[model samples]
Target: MTTLGHKSSMDHHLTGMSDNTVERPGERAPLVLNMDKFSQVTATVCRVSEAERAPIAWYICFTLSLGLLSVLGVCIGYLFLTGVGVWGLNNPVMWAYDITNFVFWVGIGHAGTLISAILFLFRQKWRTGINRFAEAMTIFAVICAGTFPGIHVGRVWFAYWLFPIPNQMEMWPQFRSPLLWDVFAVSTYFTVSLLFWYTGMVPDLATLRDRAKGKLQQLGYGLFALGWRGSNRHWHRYERAYLILAALSTPLVLSVHSVVSFDFATSQLPGWHTTIFPPYFVAGAIFSGFAMVVTLAVPARELFGLKDLITLRHLDNMNKVILATGCMVGYAYSMEFFIAWYSGAMYEKFAFMNRAFGQYWWAYLIMVSCNVITPQLFWFKKLRTSIPIMFVLSIIVNVGMWFERFVIIVSSLANDFLPTSWDSFTPTWVDIGTMVGAFGLFFTLFLLFCRYLPMIAMAEVKAVMPQADPHGAGAGKHGHAHH
Candidate 1:
């Protein structure tokens, strides 16, 4: 039957009215391709990771990322030998690039859980194609996020003091401090996200294990597969556990960024002390996270030659999400200014003004243009559908998000109430190197993931294809096996 006929039949079935049209069994709209057989879907996605040799581009990118990792090491070594004085941080602007990069990376981690958990609960089957990689990105981004705070404590050896573990000093973390709350919140977020990512990959690993060509491949994939046999009983328990994890992660997506905001909201700094920080930071987190996903996925689909699995429809959907969250972030930006002016608090008003017209107006412009204006183009269907445009905009969004943190951190601190203590901040080479190194760390892990693990979840993608629906009209009627 034609696609239109199937739609009409579906409408008729829902309305329970006889339309005099022939309703055929196994008829449904194709989500990705016209002939999406299970075998083909599995072959296409799994082929990338299981190939005898990875693409040359993978080696090139991995090499570059490794160099960045090395740069991060050198900068960190310098930091240990010298001190925080190597950076431009001083006086009122003590919290500068380090905290900004920390928050930026944490925000980048938010989209993975949002896509994996919230969308799964809503039964958005489209998420099945991208959630695996996005979850991987989340884990990597969180790792990058955690690095800054650990190093920022100034004494790496004493970092264990942040935890509640018993130490030779017999000192416990200050439970009342929000900073300590951050330690707990971030660690919990990391732990749960890791579990969620690993659980979802097991079935896919089993698929890889079955397809392995070499004994070593079989052994490695088999080790991670945990003897998954794809039995009905295994699937039943897996589904239940997956549902429970999704439910748990939904709130963590919201709470993690909110708690990160609390690190500032609980403070008395002029720009930081605001009730709107929680929701504002959450929206911004999702906004930046989706942008990063697009940035990674656009190039990824092309490089891996998995365009069919990660189709233009998927890209368009992600762009629409970026647009929505971008608007939310823009609304928050305006609201901050409005509330600042309306409250008649001179300090709040001054803080906002300094952010716009003060010494760091250039950073403010980049933040506004990238975060607010750039995403506006996605409102046009043509633009969002265009891969080149989406890729460029995605990068722009990431850069804008980093500057947003910079503006918030540096601008607020540089112009505090006591002008005598206030001083403008400038980042030293160590600051720039550390931030670049964080990117290295993130991409290095991501590259390793792409090479070793399934970059796309084959089984989940198969589960979402047209043939997966046992009751759909096209299921058994087509030359495809019913699940």
Candidate 2:
């Protein structure tokens, strides 16, 4: 079975997917992945390369991604080989890069799930184009965000100490400890996200199987597709499953970030204690997540010749979200400030003031300018649609969001209640290098995903297409209605 879909030299349906020369097991009906541009069961996998550089750009992006992953691997391995002493961490400041990086990555995970799950519930049909990729980003960013905390404990093998195993020593994990709570939260977050992402991939994998060329490709895609034929019955069940998943994910999104915030709020430490922490962390997570989505998607859209599919309209809509969430996050910052002063706690007052005018004051101001002020550009339609402007702003947002975590963690902890215990922390090259390396871990995986997986959710996209709604144009005339 050398059946190739696109007639390309490389991708032939070689090993896995055929019952005969011209017919398949379900040839009596239409195969889901063989759909046309207007397909009600498949997305338009027809990306145009005339105005974009798909392969060349892939080369460049993957190279950079691989380099970053290598750096991250070395940094982590070195952290273990040399011990925790390699980093700038000390007592009272023990939560430095470990916690900051955790929050930063977890925050990065929020936007993708929000865009896919929340917007879907709202009937925002436009999410079809980028939602698949965005969800994939959510899963991967969580993977990257999660790795740091595990290794940050210095004894990488003993990372399991965070968990309660009911072992021989009668050493129960402390229920009162926020760190233990973080263990439950992050593990649950990862499991839920994985389930959400994989369930969505099934229909898209069916599309890939139909589009496959060679026996090998066919077999590989066929297995991954899990025998999907996209019958009406399947779509009915699929849609139901998706809706249920969305409902389930909404709470997880809110709870995960809120729980992460509690890792700080539950602390008796001056800067760490705050009542508004949960909602504040959630807002910041969404804000940063959207910015990151914009940053990655802009490049992917341009490079992959998906301009029409990922139109400027999509960008404009995302800009609006980024602005809205950014504003909410900014308000959270203001609320923190107000709470600190209103509490009249000397330790709290000092923590807030020192963060602004102290040794690490610049990080705070940078966070303010980038997240609070820069997103204001979205007020202009021109800025919202302009790729160059969006690209720069997106990058700035990432930088600002990273600083938000840094300011919250490092600055707050650097100088605590005891003046004698106060000391400024700086990121060593290893810390900076490893942090930089995580980007590699992210991009490399993303690049591979785009090539193999249909970047668009084919079935979901088709389901939302105008004709897919049987009552579309014939509504009143035919005594029915469009979706």
Which candidate number would show the highest lDDT if scored against the true structure? Answer: 1
Candidate 1, lDDT over the whole model: 0.87
Each candidate's lDDT (Cα)?
Answer: 0.87, 0.78
* Local accuracy of candidate 2 as per-residue lDDT tens digits, 298-363: 988777655645666677788889899889988988888898999899989999999889989899
Tens digits of per-residue lDDT for model 1, 215-283: 998999999999999999989999999999999999988999999999999999999999999999999
Give the distance in Å from residue 208's predicted Cα in candidate 2 to where it truly belongs: 1.0
TM-score winner among the candidates?
1
Candidate 1 Cα errors over 4 Å, as ranges: 1-29, 473-483
- What TM-score does candidate 2 reach? 0.88
- TM-scores of the candidates are 0.93, 0.88
TM-score of 1: 0.93
